[model samples]
Target: MCGRFSLYSSYSTLSQGLKLPLEVAVKLTPRYNVAPGTWITAVRHPTDNEPLVMDEVWWGYRPHWAKEKAPEPINATVEKVATSNYFRGAFAHHRCLVPADGWYEWLPLNGKKQPHFLCREDREPIWLAAIWTERPDGKPGCAILTEPARGVAKEIHPRMPLALDAESLKPWLDPHLTDRETIRQVVHHLDAELITHWPVSTRVNRPTNDEASLIEPLKP
Candidate 1:
């Protein structure tokens, strides 16, 4: 599961990488350590075919039917999202792209876990597939979809956030495309070869450590 990640890259970098203009009115700053429950940037297509818009949404996903106090799920598996009680509706109609510069995963070494940062070798932002819903209060919440790990990702954890390739971004975020089968085909599993990872300081374990240094590779 992707409990934490970062988007420290600049707005121009993200814009060029994702190939979309920012639609959110607020200026986005570098975020070195992002945690769940906090507002994060999500890119989605608007109903009227306007430019893609960036919206701030809580990282955890809470479906409309869930009770007000129920725990929101942070990760929804792509395989089960089609029929899952909590994600089926969102998956079919409200898919989104959660942008990240890199994500942290803890790998067990001896008895302790060491944190590692994974991102594209080209240094471009990786787009994570997600689903979102609005609360009764009108606040939006979203969940990152996870899939079985492959290549280098398997070394850190058994599951990794489902990242999409450049070609798959459009269809995945299309507001008008609601066919389950078509949506399923749009999810492009990230190629492990496109990613690179290295051990990082454990300071990332604390959500309070948001400095850029937290992502600097630790001495091997």
Candidate 2:
């Protein structure tokens, strides 16, 4: 599952990369260590709403039904999310695009963990297909939808974010289309599309190292 990610590319770049209909309003700055519980931008197209809007949502979910003992699930299993109590409604009404320039995954090596950054070789933005739910107080919470890893990412982690390509992004973002089976078909299998990875300095492992240098390819 995607616990942390990076989308430090400028918003203009992302707006163009995602083919956003309107210019993004917020100033875009580089953020290397994007953690959960903070406001992150996501694109959503609710059927009754206007064109796709950039929304800021917390990247973690606390189900209205969660018990104190139930650890908040950052990722709702796609295998059961449609029928599950915690995810069913959001699966229908809260689908969104969690954009990222790339994401971080770790590979265990000789007594150490080496972190790898995966992104499009073209350096374009990636849209992570996600499902979000709203809190009673109107605050929104989200989770990065995950599936089996593929491409160069499999070697690093067994599961990775459901990074939707351009073609599949439409259905993923449209809230009017809520056929569970269709959504399942869209998200079920991993796409073997353009994905590239590079080794980076482990400085990304820290919560404080939030800068572009964290993603720079490291020299041995």
Candidate 3:
């Protein structure tokens, strides 16, 4: 499930591709390996007529109803998101886009898993479907939604982040639309042909290694 990913594209490129404003894009830096718990930029359409805003929030979610000591969750299964008490509120209202150039998955091999980098063949950044909420202290946090993997993603893992295309983005982020069935269908039906992936160096297993080489195809 998109536990690790990359966003090495320059702010200008990401801004242009994602349609984020220059003011917001300028604040982001090149991140080759992004992990949970770190602050991440997310795009939200607050209103139908309003321009999308880019805001930074914690990558993990800590529901307001949970105890302060509860462990934050980085991923939420799409099937349960609409009905889950901890996420229903956010699912109905706080939908967002977690933009990334690509994502990483692992193939279980021996006792270790081999890492792979997956991205769109067109080279466009992808918007991962997500839900966000505010902590009791007013801190904003988000969780990526995962679904049963299909296409290339299924080869490596059984789950992958719920990815949305241009056509699906409008409905998924429509703040006024709160119907669970509509949201589920809009996000679940994605075109698998647009994706491609390759095995990468295992260096990515370490969160500390944030370099371009980490995504390079592993040598035989």
Candidate 4:
């Protein structure tokens, strides 16, 4: 599960990488420790013919029609998202992308959990596949999609965020591509071989401890 991540890349870098004209309305900041239930940047296709739009959305999902007491999950498993009653609607119609510099996953070590930062070896931004919907309060909320971890990520945890390949970003966000099978065929995750990880300071365990040092490799 991608419970914590970082997104300190500049708006210009993200714009050039994702090839979308990100709206400057939402001020960009260097977030080295991003937690759930807070506003995060996402790219979405609001309508069938509209260009993709980048905006801030709550990092938790609860459909507007769901009961007020329904659970707002931050991550949705790819295995069931396509058919789960609570997520299928958004999965089919509201797919989006969550950009991140990297994500943190904890590994159990000597009865303690050691946090590790995972990212592409090239140091480029990763685009996590996600789905969103308007919450009862009229704010857009999203849940990042997760799948079985592969390569180095599997060594730290059994699952990881579903980061998409550059070629799949536009198709994944296409509002008209609602068929589950077709989506499965056209979209694909980034190559696991491109991912690399390193143990980081436990300071990241606290959401408030946000800074550049949080991502520094923990000294041996």
Model 4: pairs clashing at backbone N, Cα or C within 3 Å: none
Tens digit per residue, CA lDDT, model 3, 116-146 = 9998888788889998888766777899999
Q: Report lDDT (Cα) of residue 105, candidate 2.
A: 89
Ten residues in sequence with the least summed lDDT for candidate 4: 19-28
Error of 4 at 185 (Å): 0.6
The residue-by-residue lDDT of candidate 4 on 5-98, one tens digit each, is 9999988888888875544547789999999989999998765576678889999999999997999999999999999999999998899999
Best candidate according to TM-score: 4
* TM-score computed on alpha carbons, candidate 1: 0.93
Candidate 3 regions with alpha-carbon error over 4 angstroms: 19-26, 45-51, 185-189
RMSD of 3: 2.4
Sort every candidate by lDDT, greatest first: 4, 1, 3, 2
lDDT of each: 0.85, 0.78, 0.82, 0.92
Error of 2 at 21 (Å): 2.9
Query: Among all windows of ten consecutive residues in candidate 3, which has the lowest summed lDDT?
Result: 17-26
The positional error of residue 58 in candidate 2, measured at the CA in angstroms, is 0.4
Clashing pairs in 1: none
lDDT of 2 by residue, 3-24 (tens): 8889877777777667658434
Model 4 alpha-carbon drift over 4 Å, by segment? 21-24
